[model samples]
Target: MNEPCSRLAGVAVHLPETTMTTAELEDAVEARSPGVRIPRGVLERASGVRRRHIAAPHELPSDLAVAASREVLDDAGVRPAELDLIIYAGVLGDTVEPATAHVVAAGLGAACPVFDVRNACNGFANAIDIADALIARGGHRRVLITCGELLSAGIPWRIRSTEEFFAAGPHYTFSDAGAALLMEAGPAAGDGPAGGVLATRFSAESAAWALAALPVTGLSSDPDGAPLGIGRFDYDSLRFAAAFNDLDLEVLHKPLVEAGLRWDDFAAVCVHQAALPYLRAFCDRAGIPHDRTVVTIAEHGNVATASLPLQLAEAVRGGRVRRGDLVALVGLGSGIGAGIVIARW
Candidate 1:
């Protein structure tokens, strides 16, 4: 049997110092939109987000990604020159051109190939999937995946009406953060209770793309056919949930079962978390052990593509998981896409 060719070497996260509680977001909503009657504690009850971090005024997405990438690289004792590829997979970038990966590579003084992979919240996981294949091809030896999400900056502050506020509530729970993962090519480890990436599967439901979106492009105040204006967030949590509920993850879970791994077999399971309730619901529905997973949405809000890596970092920091343990990564994103990545720690 062919062995797994790539392994996750290190993971790191960087969260902005400033934080805003759900209560504060509600207060701001009322303050910004005097006409909108926002009942106190509503956002907190609905989203289950206690607070989230906010980036500094001068902070850019690349800045956060660079910080995390540097930390992970340093932690693994890997130098910038040793990297073969740098992929920035995040929701936002420093600018449209030059690719966010270029900024990250520039910060690391790396001259290797750099690119961007944008797939909503699934960006980071998608990069991992692609990097794993690249390493398997025997070309790239070391790959760096980074994401710096400054979603707080794009939050819709000015509310036109109560309906508009609720439709855009997902924005209020967003938090700014940066995360990175390092992967290296190594001797093959066959699919089993061994180290390295064991299996991966990705699925998409593009038909549900309009369930949630934010049109914050700094162009014409509002682009044609766009969902909202500057800082405008449009979301429908109910429909979003329904869409994902319909998403078929059998392909994702089949390999794990075939490998004789159950949910309890994992030392830690990291799933993309948007809200506390949604996280719990998804876990319950998927039969995932919630106790073995780190809950970040309640305290950290939704960190977008950084969610999985942050959970892994938190688990490692807390000593809940260690080397040689089996772990699983489940990714659910705004594209209504889902993916599964199981590996040995």
Candidate 2:
């Protein structure tokens, strides 16, 4: 088989120090709605999450990104000056105008071209695709990809229904986290136990975009008091189950077929840690074994784009994956975007 030019050199993760247990989250939600009744144990079992970490009140996404990036660079033995590009792939940004990547680049003391990629949950995988192209075309020799998710900011605190649903399970499981991966040019550039990108396939279902979206119409600011608005987080569990199942099956088919491999070819699958139910449904539809799939959503909630790399770093750190192992990185998120990349570890 023909080998790819770019590879993943190293990976690092940064987790918040503050841990919030399922019961605590339930209490917080119940406080918002005194009449709401939610079972803490039910929420825990449904989400498969025991506790999650959140950033300190003053911490920002960039802070976590800088720490994670430094760790990755240190592990890769690559200096900041050597980096050619830096990409921040996450839903949360330091600001709306100046790209989060610019802030992260400045913090890392990296003098490289920087930008942000917003594919929602698929941001990391999309960033990897871009980095691979840059390395292959010689536009960049080394690229640093970072993602920081401040999911806490997205929580809908005012809505009684939303509060109840979140407290019920999936909402409490989200933890703040940041992750970084260093990608370098050349087929033999990877120094870690995992090899770089082997092949990648991407597919989009724009028609289903409305199925999972943060609709602007749902937001409204209170004129009398502190800024108060509703952020549309319309994720119908039933709709998601149908959409993601179809999307995953469609996306994985060509990638696996093009690579001339089957489900058993990969030793492990590192996919977006969106939620427990979504992950399990995708695996069932894709025919991927649960044991081969990595689950961090219970502990980290949905780190948006950072989920995949965080899972990969955990696999590497735990010694579950080794060199020359065929690993599949799958991403599924808003825009109903789904993509699969086969990497040799």
Candidate 3:
């Protein structure tokens, strides 16, 4: 028996309405803390993110997912009953109890077996890998992968010191968005000059997971009085960069080898939008040309699991990718997990 090839059926994105500029976030941070100050344009300069979309107060991650899912299903012309699986892959869910996929499935009236696949930001790509295997095994034909990240909502706005603000700066680069991809069984030969998934590979660097862990529960002082159970975040940017370099070659090599492809084979590369600087550095190390990658961080910020898919959607729509063009989806996230999926589009 041979592995079945999955075709790229459709991709879509749903962004929130509200936009938060760097200056606005800076002001919000400064105003909430009595003695803390963040210089104007600091975040913009550091992250290359001019602004980020923020969800409405009443909007949940599931809502965004459903919106994107609808667009994908409609584009693919796949009915809810025809879907074999639905995987909600994102950082935050509507509830910690019921799997977020459940809510999204209900919204779509999808009766398929649904669940969540979380690996920080690598979720969408990871879900694809799972779906790919299931398809190859012949149990499933169509799988829908969706992600909605609302990381911006988790920013603790009460920090009162330079250290706390700096620790939280990474949070500032996050945005809210949802994206979806539909993969279905297709002829392997169609990937050439047509859209299909060629191969996918995933790897991890668990040892470096602690370098960029986020939103851990901690104590914070309120201006009015007592301590509050606000979430705190910390990141060692230098350490993370070093770890990426250390593992870069191996991570990319295994995938290319297994797929029997080269970095130059891709017409465009879409990676996790960590930040503009880190993204550039990663591209440089991987020997992928700068122009060959599509970046959305400057305008969309780091949208977590939605990053890669959002980039892919934009690239496809913008004509950066054409039929038979090979595109690489590289996802790197906390837990230090990484994965790559090569598709023809």
User: What's the TM-score of every candidate structure?
Assistant: 0.92, 0.88, 0.91
State which candidate has the highest lDDT.
1
lDDT of 3 by residue, 1-345 (tens): 455677778899999989988888888888988988777787788888998999988888999999999999998788999999999999888876689999999999999999999888888888888887787778889999998888878676788787877667788888999999998986653535544676777788898888877553434455665544334456787797788777755766677787777777888888888789888988888887888889899989889999988998999899887768898998888777777887887
Question: Which regions in candidate 1 have their CA more than 4 angstroms from the true location?
Answer: 1-4, 190-194, 215-231
Q: Write the per-residue lDDT of candidate 2 for residues 89-152, one digit (tens) a residue.
A: 9877787669999999999888888999988788889999999988877678899999888777
Candidate 2's displacement at residue 260, Å, is: 2.1
Candidate with the larger TM-score of 2 and 3: 3
Deviation from native of the Cα of residue 330 in model 1, angstroms: 0.4
Select the stronger candidate by lDDT from 1 and 2: 1
| Model 2 spans > 4 angstroms off | 1-4, 157-170, 188-195, 215-230
Error of 3 at 217 (Å): 6.0
Q: What order do you get sorting by TM-score, best first?
A: 1, 3, 2
Report lDDT per candidate.
0.87, 0.78, 0.83
List the candidate 3 regions with Cα displacement exceeding 4 Å: 1-3, 189-191, 215-231, 257-260
